[model samples]
Target: NSGYQQQPRQQAPQQFNNQNRIQSMNQFDLIPMSYAELFPALIEKYLVQTRASPPVLAKLPW
Candidate 1:
């Protein structure tokens, strides 16, 4: 009876350590955005910057 009671207490720490190790290993994998997701944001930022700027003198023939 006592062995069974102690079994759960020992297993809990092992399970927690395994989960922590897995999370640490995965943390870096989660930080970066895939190019498909990042490309649209880059395009939108470029468009916004171009729209905010005045037209170039060269673009105007006058």
Candidate 2:
């Protein structure tokens, strides 16, 4: 029980830092886009990636 509670406390800051790092690394990256803004572009990108690469995205733990 104590370990479970500690997990989130540790992960929350790490995830926030990762997001900040990504945004800082690329000012024009898609982290801030809404669904409507992403619809057309995201589909094209997703389709291209699936065709160009193996389906590694499906193997994510999440």
Candidate 3:
């Protein structure tokens, strides 16, 4: 056959998983946005949701 085939004697090096690499990226929470930057409905919904959430003094895990 003229088709190329891998040599059984050769071994490919293992590669690191992308999931681990992506997770190692810097963590950022809650992108900044003003009411003017958001749709009117979205702004109103976010305000209502935030108001409804209980106030707590707990640190979030990154």
Q: Which has the greatest lDDT?
A: 3
Evaluation by TM-score, superior candidate among 1 and 3:
1
Candidate 2 positional error at 41, Å: 1.2
Give lDDT for model 3: 0.47
- Candidate 3 lDDT, 27-59, residue by residue in tens: 344324543444465767775443466777589
The C-alpha stretches of model 2 lying farther than 4 A from their native spots are 1-30, 47-62
Per-residue lDDT over 1-62 for candidate 2, one digit per residue giving the tens place of the 0 to 100 score: 12211111222232346346522221233344455554578777784243465666756787
Model 2 residue-pair collision total? 0
Give the TM-scores of the predictions, in the order they appear: 0.25, 0.22, 0.16
Each candidate's lDDT (Cα)? 0.44, 0.43, 0.47
Superpose all Cα atoms of candidate 1 onto the true structure and report the RMSD in Å to 1 decimal: 21.3
Ranking by lDDT: 3, 1, 2
- lDDT, candidate 1, residue 24? 22
Q: Candidate 2: worst 10 consecutive residues by lDDT? A: 1-10
Clashes in candidate 3: how many?
0
Clashing pairs in 2: none
